[model samples]
Target chain A: MKDRVTTPLGAVTLLLLLVAVGLGLSSPLDVNQGSLVRLMFVHVPTAWVSYLAYGGTGLFGLLYLITRKRRWDRLAMASGELGVLFTVATIVGGMLWAKPTWGTYWVWDARLTTTALSLVVYGGYLLIRAMIDDPERRARVSAVVGIVGTLYVPINYMAVEWWRGVHQTQTLKLLGKVRFDAAPIYGWVLLIATAAFTLLYIYLLRVRGIVAARDEAREERELMNDLQGDLNSLTPQGGLRG
Target chain B: MDKYAVYVIVVYVVTLLLLGAYLVWLAQRLRATRNEAGLTEQVRATSTPGNQTSSRQTPGKRG
Candidate 1:
């Protein structure tokens, strides 16, 4: 059992994360924000990974609908679960950083509000899935939820611009003209941290998929056992089922 | 730096704890399932009428 748990991907992720942390420490601090800026290494990437995980959930959900495959559903479910985890991380990181800078743990900033809303939507997706016992029906119902819940992601992203919220505007943009507004060293460290966290999300997704697949298999086995028991009860002691 | 050290430590530590907990739990779960499935396979093999040899050396055969 000890030997059975090897994970090359996980090991790599850990190493990369260590490197990211080292870079973060060595990088210069913000002139105004000071050492508190180091929190961005975790904060920014956690938010990005949350968004990525939710997008993965919606993508897999769409594929499940199109192909009617359990694999897609399992991936979608894992993605949604991890999406929630990362979002929680984002919130925690944000709060921790906010206390030092904003002098408060929370504010009614539009970005924060929308991110919280998206969290609730995905949380409901998991809750709804748990309520349905039928595997096919559970997948079908949650696939719709997963797909629709992710519609909030874009809104969450645009919240800063749309509402002109207190949260800082996007300083690192991937599309359109590339933007890296921070110090070059900090930018590189942030990039590495982002890449590391993204990989971490993917590795966790794979691990969680195994859990989902095993659960499905166990349910199928239990259903089969029930059917076998029913058959045994129907047949005579010395007959076919016996 | 020392003034805000607690916040940085908390964020990094909490993130690590959360991640490590989930990963460890997943590994334990997968190992438990693998062992359970193996046990079930061995039971089924040994219980079948003609698997006397397998029954006698089920652990050995698997190893």
Candidate 2:
């Protein structure tokens, strides 16, 4: 049974996914949205994962600055990359859900607007990394960018409440505050789905971080080889002397 | 099917497709990195004098 899992975290993710599907698809429909409410299971969770991913990027970026660890910086980059992917998922999923509910694909509502900003900000975060050549300099500069770029997260969270937009308010809030306009099973499905998405994030982060580290190592090795080849050509013995 | 079922299905299908594509890409990248790193190690190991490997090919570009 254990071997069925690719990784322990992956196993948990798969299990939670199964539970979420079992409950989410079978749960009673929303009074207002009907079967369309099923989309919430995917939309809400992907949005939440985007939050967690960006938050992880900021946290790891800060840690990289403080500890000066290469792995931390690599993990930060991995998280940012994943954040972009999930953010795109969130936006598209929300837009699809919106069309059925609100009869439109998108609006300039506060939450939606800030979400669009999130795509820009995190997208810029990735773009800046590619423009810098030195890894150390890139890590330092992007660590600062990563940290500051996430300032919009809290604002994004509070947008609906503060600005009163067409977008709905958060389903779950901090400090034991919870709101569910649907059946209890719907809530359960949501909880499981969110957990499943969170676990999936962790699993992907682990795999991506390993790949990122190896890529960085390979890049550095290539750079070293280039430098060595140049030195060999400069020697007095056909290298170094020049 | 309900009137809005198509919308629901579209969202799920698109989301799943995007996620599956990302996972596949990640898996391919991991394989590429492993192969590239292995070649780098092999090159370094054989670079010792009198132990030169015939192939002096540089590692190929990665995604």
Candidate 3:
């Protein structure tokens, strides 16, 4: 009954714009990375949101099985789809940054390889859902897959620490101390970008949910029609004659 | 400043373009699907006749 685009979605759009402006002005360009560092404003947020989105899918997948709610399944699927997009964005952005800094577009380093594997796992989840015709069965199997895929997130985070690799150490965290200077402008920018990306993710998930819900409704209608037609066929002929 | 500046800029620009295009595509698809569902619901409501009333009336028949 509510307008899908104008209410929650409008709020998200405004938040994203505010954050984008804050991030743009606050963070100084890295002395070494130069202007390329600005890309981090987008890249890091995408990566973070992708992780959050996928985690949400896993959580909803679990809840759906227990609650037996079709709505939860729909939400899980929508989140998974959005997660894949963000993951793709993260990978492409990382590769772009890598080429300039590491002198190669890709390497089989622990972090990159594990992250790629994570992407493949989620991609397989969608493929498996497509391969099944029954909605209930699809949700059950995909839920299992979603739970298993979550194990890779922690591995992806720790890949740099666990192995010697070409990937530079994480810049955002260090030995119980935040290294980056927390000047007001920089702090405000990061906060804004983070807020914006989070809203963008929510907006995307909502749109996808609406699309999925419509598809389900359409399927239900077709199924009902088919059942009715079958029933009509089975009914006795009007006349008693042969 | 660095030689790879061009590459970074190109990559960022391309990413923005791709994501922008995708969002637009999603919005269009959402509109189309909603429209299709609405039309289908209308058709079903009209074509189904008194089946709805019959179901409510025949609740005690318990097949």
Among the numbered candidates, top DockQ falls to 2
**Cand. 1: chain B TM-score:** 0.64
Please report, in order, the local distance difference test score of every candidate based on alpha carbons.
0.86, 0.85, 0.77
Which ranges in model 3 have alpha carbons more than 4 Å from their true place? A4-8, A18-22, A25-27, A174-187, A236-242, B1-9, B48-63
lDDT (10s digit) by residue, model 3, range A1-242? 87767466757676675558445534566667776676676777788888888898898899988998988888888888888888888889888888778889899999889888878988998888889888899889888888778777777877888997998666566447767543455556666776788888888787778788888888887888788777777768732231
Q: What's the ranking of the predictions by TM-score, best on top?
A: 1, 2, 3
* lDDT (Cα, tens digit) per residue for candidate 2, span A1-242: 22233477777887887777666666677777899889889989998898888898899999999999999999999999988899999998888888878989999999999999999999999999999989999999999999998787888888888999798877776535566765677788888889888888888888899799888997898799899998898787876645
Candidate 3 chain A lowest-lDDT run of ten? A233-242
- lDDT (10s digit) by residue, model 1, range A1-242: 34344388888998999988777765676788877888889889999999999999999999999999999999999999898988988898898888878989999999999989888999999999999999999999999989898898889988888899679988786657988888888888999999999989988898888878877888898999888778777887934535
For model 1, the stretches where C-alpha displacement exceeds 4 angstroms are: A1-6, B52-63
DockQ of model 3, rounded to 2 decimals: 0.37
- Residue A149 in model 1: lDDT: 85
DockQ of every candidate structure: 0.49, 0.57, 0.37
RMSD of each: 4.1, 5.0, 6.4
Question: Which is better, 1 or 2, measured by lDDT?
Answer: 1
The CAPRI quality class of candidate 3 comes to acceptable
Candidate 2 residue spans exceeding 4 A from truth? A1-6, A175-181, A240-242, B49-63
Which residue pairs collide, candidate 2? A234-A239, A234-A240, A235-A239, A235-A240, A235-A241, A236-A241
B26: Cα error in model 3, Å: 1.5
Model 1 residue A69 distance off true place after TM-score fit, in angstroms: 1.8
TM-score of chain B of each: 0.64, 0.63, 0.56
